[model samples]
Target: MNSVQKLGFSENAKLLIIHADDAGLSHSENMATIQSLEEGFVNSYSIMVPCPWFYEMAVYAKNNPKFDYGIHLTLTCEWENYKFGPVSPVSEVPSLVDENGYFYKKREQLRKSATPEDVKKELQAQVEKAIKFGLKPTHLDSHMYSVGSDAKFLKVYKEIGEKFDLPVLINKQLMQMVGLDPDINIKEGEFVIDNTYIGEFKYFEDGKLGDFYKGIIENLTSGINLILIHPAFDDSEMKGVTINHPNFGSQWRQIDFDFFTSEINKAKLKENNIELVTWGDLNKIRKGK
Candidate 1:
């Protein structure tokens, strides 16, 4: 059966997952995630286990068990000044890190050096670490979709989900965005979210990101859809982390926080007859399976 039918909706139901990515990147990120989830349209989010702010977020997740959260299996640290590394010891996942013992800044750099074994080890370690901290993660997804950089790493991503028995964020478009051949990499009958949306750099540059998102709600299609956003304040901490990176920089994230949390955005979904779902809801389906 299709996702809509599985969710007990009509076949033509427009199910949407407004997911906030990067919850544990910083204090600003954690605070924004909390507010967005508690008071905004964001229903799902994932945590970056290797980031310095992970424990703070984890504490909140532990206190509030009803919220939907997943592990953002991170491999590359994209920030300029602030950075993080593997959860496993550097000695164990040496190939996954640079000389500074932190994750590489780009996926291409990680793909060039990361061995499949090390990738599996680090990703699995991230999952285990989350569980160890008493935060029950509902699903798994990749940070920057880094697992799709190589086919072997993609396989590792799937295997880790199976090992942990959690659903993964699998989509052909995400794989193709990372230069993986989706037809060859994704198997037949596998669950894939083909209609995933994220704000483009052009939208941020043109100051039309809110319009871009509004259009998405207006034109949403049948089956499952996803909109990945990063909610953070444009503060000194975020500015320091995103220095020289204006694409998903501090101000851009602030726009994301404001737009997703607006009552008008929530009303637009209801008026358009769109149904919002969560990774936690999806986890119940996986567990039942």
Candidate 2:
């Protein structure tokens, strides 16, 4: 039996947490995530509760409670045209929402004017909304790593996580769960990458996708490794929405999908016998299965 199955999870032997982020951002993302989960390519996913399509994804979760899912705490609406406002009222979270009634476009912008009280209220509202929709999220994480960058935000996030009895992804926890620290720099372009973090989550700038595959292969850890990736097909809709976004839009996300399913990645995982586990199984292990 594989590590996850040994721990009394589903008979599937591998223990992986292949998650698709921004589930409610667009139909393309939602469809891809569902397909990947059905195909056994992705084991878990997270939803952006503030986005337009959040209700659809929430309904899917309610119908399929067996699917390991979580909340991707959305503090900013990075994309234009397809923007989302705060889950709480504008009066309550005015610091997080912009003048146009949408959330801030970037972390730095939010940090400049945001307060801890507003963040706490907004986060609680998100959780309440999810529960109201009959969704019991498996875990919690920031949409754009907003909680991790600021100490005040991190404190609120951790408190909310504990209150909900959910695990919040932390570099300290990740390092402790996994064996070693990665060698590369963890920060890139307003995004913070955690080294205890396995996987190449950074945007590929002038580098081949092979390098990312190699990075994951070379850095496989003994315990649970949670790698985050945004997978989407490069279509006109996604392009139009995300084009000119500094984060490389669908190009980087498509490359992430390719790297995740690449031959080199398969070979490395098979060679190392690394298990792909979901957060559910990982939590079980943490709780001393």
Candidate 3:
């Protein structure tokens, strides 16, 4: 059965998951993500376990156990100045790190060097650390799409998700985007969204974010849809953290925050009859399976 039916929704129901990514990269990111989850249309977020602000996110998750948060299983630290390495010992997962002893700054670098054993070790360590800090993570997803970039990495990612009984973010569309076979068999009972949208900020050149999102919401199909957004305050902190990167930088994130939080966006959801579901809700389906 498809996700909508499996979740007990009508066949034509438009299910949407507005998930904020990079929740623990910096103070600005943490603050914006918390606000977006608590006060805005964003229903879910994932914590970057290897980032500097991970402890802050962990404490928040511990205190607010009801929020739908997950581990953004991190392998590559893509910032210029800001960087992090494996939660496991460097000696143990040596192939997962660069010469500087930090995670490689790009997915291409990681894909060339990281071994499956190292990936599994580091991923397990990240999940274990989150659980140790009192976070019952709702799901798992990759940072920089690293884990899903290769078949071997994906194998370890799937294994870890199965081990934890948490949903790993995977979709046929995304698989195809990375030159993987879209028809790759997923284990029975594993939750997979039918479609996932990661906003392309290049389309937001001339105050077009509202239109871009509205178009996406309107075009959403029957099955579950996950929209990945990075919501952060456009402050000095965020600016500094995302110094050279304009793709998902401070201003870009603020636009996401603004659009997702706007009353018009809420109205659009109601107008389109889109049912916002959380990763926690998806977990219920996993449990039943």
Candidate 4:
């Protein structure tokens, strides 16, 4: 049988994977994630373990263990003022860090400079930190698809996932067409929502964000559908934090908030009989297997 069949997901029912990215970035991100979780617009979220406010989010997770969360394994510090130092000491994984002691500025720089051994060491350090902080993560994924893009990195990441017995996201198309192997050795879950399913979510756009409700009209398939969103307030905090980011993750995140909470989108889903789900379900299914 194929990967999806191995995971035990029903082939007929459409599964929705609404995951919120960037959970431990700032207060804006934290508040947004909580609101989205309560609102039922987002099913899963990942935390940047190396972020400055990581412990705070970890505490929240410990208290409210019901939320489905994963580690957004961070290898690079993309922001300027907002940056995190390496979890592994400089002496241990010197290549993963810069002269100033933080991680490299970009993925390309890290990919070029870091050795496979150094990458593995840093990943272990980050995961250890999360466990130290009392986070029983539901799954594993990269912050910027760092593991998925590089073969060596992917190997280390998958090793960790298998060691921990956690479920990870690996696009089937990438596996076939791009030759991106799974970071872990486990069989693919029964449920599968390929990227093509997510590519169809045009729920929210600029200006007329209200018009996105029309998207729910399309009949959804029975398989899983993962909808990725980055939601945050365009407050002074997010603005100041993401000043140099041209893609404006903070600003674009605010746009996600608009789209997710829009009544049009909610009504459309209700009208189309779409059911939302969380990664917690996937974790349970994988754990049962």
Q: Estimate each model's TM-score.
A: 0.98, 0.80, 0.95, 0.82
lDDT by residue for model 2 over 142-185, one digit each (tens)?
78777654567777887888788777766553333323232221
**Candidate 4 Cα errors over 4 Å, as ranges:** 1-10, 172-193, 196-220
Best by TM-score: 1
lDDT of candidate model 1 versus the reference? 0.91
Compose the digit string of candidate 1's lDDT tens values, residues 44-156: 89999999999999999999888889999999998888979999999999999999999998999989999999999999999999999998888899999999888999999
Residue 260 alpha-carbon offset, candidate 2, angstroms: 3.6
Among the numbered candidates, top lDDT falls to 1
Cα lDDT tens digits for candidate 3, 8-107:
8898999999999998999999999998888789999999998899999889988988788999999988778777888888999999898879999877
Return model 3's CA RMSD, one decimal.
Answer: 1.6
Candidate 1 has a TM-score of 0.98
TM-score of 2: 0.80
- Candidate 3 has its poorest 10 consecutive residues by lDDT at 182-191
- Show where candidate 3 strays beyond 4 Å: 185-190
Q: Runs in model 2 with CA error above 4 Å?
A: 1-16, 172-203, 246-248, 261-268, 286-289
